[model samples]
Target: MCKLYQFVPIFCISLSVVCAKECSIVVLEDSNEFIKIADCSRRGLSQVPQTLPRDITVLNLRRNNFQIISNFSFKRYRFLQKVTLSENKLQKIEDQAFFGLSRLNNLNMSDNTLDLLTVYTPEMFLPIENLTVLDIQRNIQEHNNDVYRYPDVAFGVFKKIVYLALDLAPIPELGQGFQNLQNLKSLIFDRCFLKFLRGDTFENFTSNLEELRLTRCLHYFLHVDDNALSPFPKIAKINFEGSCMHLKQALSMLSSYSGKTLDIINLRGLNCPRFNSDEYPFVLTVTKDMMRYLKTVCVETLDLSDNGIVDFEENSLLSFDRPECIKHLYFKGNRFAFTKGRQIDELNTFFNKSIALKTFDYSFIPVRYWLEENAVHHNEQNYHSSNNIIYLPRSLEKLILSNLLCNDIRRHFMNRRGSNLTYLDVSYSYSNNVVIFESNASFTTETLVLDGHFHAALYQIEIVNFIHVKTLLWRSANLLYAMYPLDNMFYKRFITWFRKLKKLEHLDMSSNLLWILPDDLFLELDRLSELRLSKNLFQSVPTQIIFCSTIKTLDLRNNLLSTVDYATRVWADLMSTNHGFSLYIEGNAFECKCDNLNFIKWIQETKVDLDSRSYKCTLLNGTVITVLEAYETMHDLFSNCRNSIWLTVSSTLLGTSIIGVVLLIIYSKRWNIAVFFYRKFRKMVEKNMVKVTLMMFSFHMAGTAYLGLHNV
Candidate 1:
C-alpha cells in the first residue's frame, strides 16, 4: 500500500511538467495568450534563449555574458513591454537593437560597460520612443575632457518618459539633457557631485517634477541657494540619504519647503563635512529658532535617523504653526541630553504641542535616572517623582524605545488621558538597576515586544490588565533553571504571566535555551496561532505544545532534536487534520537507524508541512544522507533489524524446551532413588556390631591362661 501511494506524487509531477512550457527559461506568470514573465537571469548564457514563447511580455536577462546587443535580438518578442539587461558586458548596442519593441515602457540597463556618449544615439532610441521609465545607472562614463557633454539627442526623443535614473556626470547645472523630458515627474541621480546649486540649476525641468532622490552624494561641503528649489514649488518627496551636509544646509533645505506639505522627507546619515572637523562637528540643537523654519510645512513622515541631535529648547514645537500635521518622527541613534530634570520638562512641552503625532521612534538613545530635590510621592509607586506627569500624545499609536540605557520606563510617556497604542517595542532597554512592574500600570497595546530582560521583575505584577495585547515577543530572556536558585519557580512565574494574555495570537520565545516546559504552559493560550521556540536546547519535540489546537506554525529550528519519534509523528498527524500546521525542524541533528524507522516513514506519509529538502540525517555507519534518500533505501538500511527480531524469538523457545525436558526426567525416578539410600545405611550399622564382639572374646582367653601358669 505504501509503495502504491508513492506513485501518486510521481504521476502528478509528470502531469505538471507536461503542462508547463518546454523552455530553459523559467516561466513566472502566464496568461491566456501570453507568458507574462520569463526570467533567464544568472544563467551564464552568452546569448538570449530563442526557445521561449514569442508572446512573452516581460523578459529578465540580467547577469549574462552578452557583449553586444545585436540588431533585432529581441524582435521575436515584440509583445515584451519591459526588459532588464543590467549587469551585462554590453559595450555596444546595434542601431536597431530595439527595433520592434515600440510598446516597451520600462528598460533597465544598469551596471553595464556602455559609455554614455558613444552608445547613446538618436537611432538607438528611435524604436522605443514610447519608453516611460529608463534606468541606466552605474554605467561607464567615458569623458575624455572636462567640456564633454551628454548625448542629448538620444534622450530628447523620450518626450513621454515619466521616471529616469542615471549617474550625474559632474555638471555645474541641470543642462538641456533633461529639458526634453517635459512629462517627467520623478528623477533619481546616483553618485551625484553637486557642491553648489544656483537659482537656475533646474531651469526647464521644474513644472511637472514632484519627487527627487539624490542618494550617496557625499561631498566635503554643500551649499543650496535660497532660490535654488524655488522654481519647483510642487515637489513633495525628497531623499538625500548618505549625504554629508552640515546641519545648517539641511535646515536651509527644510526651510525651502516652508508652506508645502511633503509626503516623505528622508535625511538619514546627514552629517558634517569631513574637512575642518575640529571646528564644526555638526552637533545640532532643535531650538525654537530652528522650529520657526518648519512652522508652516506639514510633513507626513520625517526620517532624521543617525543625526547627532543632542538637545531641544523649551517650547520648541510651540514655534511651529502646524505642529499637529506631523504624523511620524524617527530619531534613532541620537544622544539626547536627558540627564537633567529640565530636559524632561522641555520634551514633555514639545510632545504636548504635537497633538496629531501618530508614531515616534526613540530607540538607541542613552538615558539616566535622577530625583528632584523635593519630590512628591505617589501612591502607586510610578517612576515619575515630580508633581508634573510626562504624558505622550494621546494620538500616538506606535512607539519604539529599543536598546535605550534608561533605568526606568514608567517615568516617561504616562498619558493622563489613557493612551491606546497599537504597537510598542521596549526590547533590550532594561538596565541592571531597572525596577520591574511594581505599579498598577495597565497597557492596551495590541503588539508588545519585551525581548532581552529578566522575568523576575514582573513575577508579581498584574498581568491580567493587559487586555488588548495579541502579539508578544520575549526572545532571549534566559528562561533556564541554572540562572535561578529555585527549581522550576521561575518557569512557573513565566507561565503564569503568559497565561494571562488570553487574547495573544503570536508568541516568540526563541533563543532561550529551554529544554522543558510545564504541560499546562500553553493550555490557556486558546487563540495562539504561531509559536516560535527555535535556537533552544530541546532534545525532542516538546509535547507541551499539544495543548493549543489553534497553532498553525511551530518553529523548532536550530535545536538539539535527534529525531521525530513515532509518538510525536502520530500526534502531529492528528493535529494537522483540523488546521494546516507547519513544523520547521531544519538545522536539527537527525539520526537514521531502525530506532527511527517509523519516523522516516512518517516523513513521507504525514500531511504536516515539514521542509524536507533541508533534512540531513546521520546513518549507522557514520555516513550522512538526506531523509528522503534513507526512505528510498529503507529495506537495505533496516535488513539486519528484521533478521535479528526472528533470531531472538527462536533462541528463547529452544532454551525453554531444554529446561523442561531435564525437569521431567528427574521427577520420573524419584521413588527408586530414595530406596537405594535406605539399604546402604542398614549394611553399615551391622558391620560395626560384629567387630566389637570379636574383641571381647580375645581379652577373656588371655586372663584364664595367666592363672594356669601361676599354679604350676
Candidate 2:
C-alpha cells in the first residue's frame, strides 16, 4: 500500500505545476461566473503583467507610469469586458494593443497623456468590436491644439459605443464619424471649447441618442443652429449648464425639442444678453419670446435656478401654449422685484398658466427696495383688484417664498386654489398677515415656517390657522415681547390659541428675547419631540419642561443660565422614565464656585447626552474651564470652603457658650456674692486702719533713726 500511494504522488505534482504556469497572475473572483477581475493599479509597473488569468473580464491599471500599451497586451485575456487605464503616463497605445479582446465592452483612457485617436485610423479601435462605453476625457495636454479627428471607418469600428465622454478633448468638426455611431445614446462634451452647434451637428445621432451634455462650453458665445435637435425624437435629457448661450441660440435649442417628451432640461446659469434691459441692467427677464420656446418643450422638471432672472415680463407666462407639462420649477437665488402691484399681478398670472405645477421655489428673491417704495401702491391696487385675492395653481403642493420683503402677505393666501398644499415656507419675509385661511377652509399642510420678524396680527392669525401643522418654526420673531412684559392677558391669548395645536411635533422658537417661560406654556403640546429655545435670555431651565414626556431633543444653548439644578432634575426625570433626550446646554454662564459644586459634579456624572465639552464655568479668579475639567480641580476648593465655614461657625458657637456660662454663674450667685463682698469690704477697712497706724509708727521710727544718724 505504501508503494502505490508514493507512485500516485508523482503524477499529481506534475499536474499542479502545469496549472500554476497557465494561471500564474493574481485574480479576484466575482459573484458572476462569467466575469473575473484583476487590479494591478498603482503598482509601479512599467508593463502589463505577463501571466494574467485567461478568464479575467475586468482589469484596472490606473495611476501607473506605463509609457506604452504594446500590441497584443491583452491577447490571452480574450474575454475581457472592461479595461481602465486612467491617471497614467501612457503616451502611446499600439493599434492592436487590445488584440483578440472582442468581448470588451468598456474602455476608459481618461486623464492620461495619450493621443490615441488624433489620427483617426480604423485600427485605433479594431480589437474591441463590442465596446459600448468609450471615455477619453482629459487626455491631451493644455497647449496641444491638435483636435481628435474621427475618420469614417473609425466610427464603424466603434459603432457599438452607446456612451461617449469626450470632455476637454476638442474635435475639429462634426464629421461622418458621429454619423456612423448609430447605437450611441449618450454624448458628453463638457469643456470642449465648442463655439458653435450647427444645424446638422447632431443629425446622425438624432434617432438613437437619449442624453446630451454640453456643460461649460463656449466661453464667448454658443451659436445653436435652427432645428439642431428636431430629429431627436427619443432624446430625454439635455443639459447646457454654465454655457454662455445667446438668447437666439437658446430659443432655437428649445424650439428643436418642441412637442417632444423631455424628462429634464437643465439650463442653469445660462447667460442671455438679449434679455438684459435698462430697467434691470444686470439681470435677465423672462420675456414672452423665451416663454414661447419653453412652453413648446414637454418637460417634467425645468431647473432655471441661478440664471440672473430679475422679473418676468407682464403676461410672459400667458404666452405658454402648454404650461401644464412642467411639474417643478426652481427659481431660487434670483433677484426678483415682485413688490409692485403690476409685478405681483404678473406673477399671479404666471402661476395661473402652470396649473399642473406641484412645486415652486422662489426663495431668496430680494424685493426690499421695491417693497419700500411701492408697498402702499401695491396695497391700494390689491384692494381694488379681485377683492384683494392672489391665486395659486390648483395643483401646487409645495411653495417656498422665503427672504421676500413683502409687508402684507395676506393677499397670497386669499382664495388659494390648492387644498393639497402640504409644505409652505415663508421664512425671512417681512409680512404683516401671512396666513389668511377662510373660516370654512381646511388644509392638509403638515409643515409651516414663519421664522422671521412679523406683525402681531400675523402671529395671531398664524397661531389659529396652523393648528394642524406638525412642524412649526417661528424663530427670531420677537414674539416674546410683542406685548410688553408678557402680561397675563397676552399669556392667556397665546395659550388659548397655542393649546389648539395638538399635532405640533417640532417647534422652534429660538433667538426670541424670552426671559421666562410660563409654567404651562408647553403642556398642551403632547406630541412635541423637538424644542429649540436657544439664544434667549433664560437664566434657568423652565420647570414646565418636565411636562414634555415625549421630548427627545431639548436645545437650551447660548442662554444666561448659571446653575444646573433644574437641568439636573429635568435630566433625572427624563432618564428615570427611560425617555432618551439630548440636552444642549452649552454656552451658558455657569458659575464655578462652591455654591455650584453639586451642579458641576452632576454634569460630570450625567448619563444623559449633553454637549458638556463646551459647558464652561467662570471661576472666582475669572478663569474659565470646561465643566468636566473644572470638576476635576474644584473638589478640594469646595472642601476647603466647607471646612472654613464650619471652623468659623464652631469658633463663634464656643465663644458664645463660654460667655453664657459666665453670665449664668454671676446671675445665680448674685446675693451671695454681694453679701460676701460687703463683709470683706468691712474687714478690709479695719485692716487698712490697723495697717495705717503701724505704718505711721514705723515711719516715725524711721524718721527718728534717720535724724539720729544725721546728728551723729
Query: Candidate 2, which segments miss by more than 4 Å at Cα?
Result: 1-251, 271-281, 310-315, 333-355, 367-383, 406-412, 416-418, 431-435, 456-463, 488-493, 566-579, 590-607, 610-620, 627-712
lDDT digits (tens) for residues 1-712 of candidate 2: 0111110111222321322111113444444455556666766555666566567788788787777888887888888889989888888877888789888999888887766355335786787878999887776455244554545467567877899887533334456556778888898876556555776566655387899888876444555676777667678988888776643356557776676678888877666454354543336777877676777677878877667776677766434556778788877767764544776666677677787889878777654433565555554643554444557676888888777654543454543534567888878865432445555556767888877764543545544565788998888888776534556345556667677888989989899898887658787899998889999998988777776788888889999999867555655556545877688888889888877777877777767777664478888889887777777777655667788779999999999999999999999999999999999999999999999999999999999999999999
lDDT per model, in order? 0.72, 0.71
Please, what are the lDDT tens digits per residue for candidate 1 over residues 1-712?
A: 0111110111212321232222233344333543467776776655555566687788888887768887887889889999999999888899988999998999999989887767888898989989999999878444222534667778888999999888655454345766889888888877566566556767757466888887765643556666666667788888877766655466666666787788888877777535336433667666676566566788888787767777677756335566677889888887664433666676676678888888988888765543444232333375445523456777888888788765433354564335656787778875322222325444767887878865633552533356577998878877665234445556556656667888999989899888877667788788999999999999998887875778888899999898976667766787789878888999898998878888888888888988664488998898999888889998988799788878888899898899888878767876776777777777777777777777777778888899899998
Best by TM-score: 1
Model 2: pairs clashing at backbone N, Cα or C within 3 Å: none
TM-score of each: 0.77, 0.60
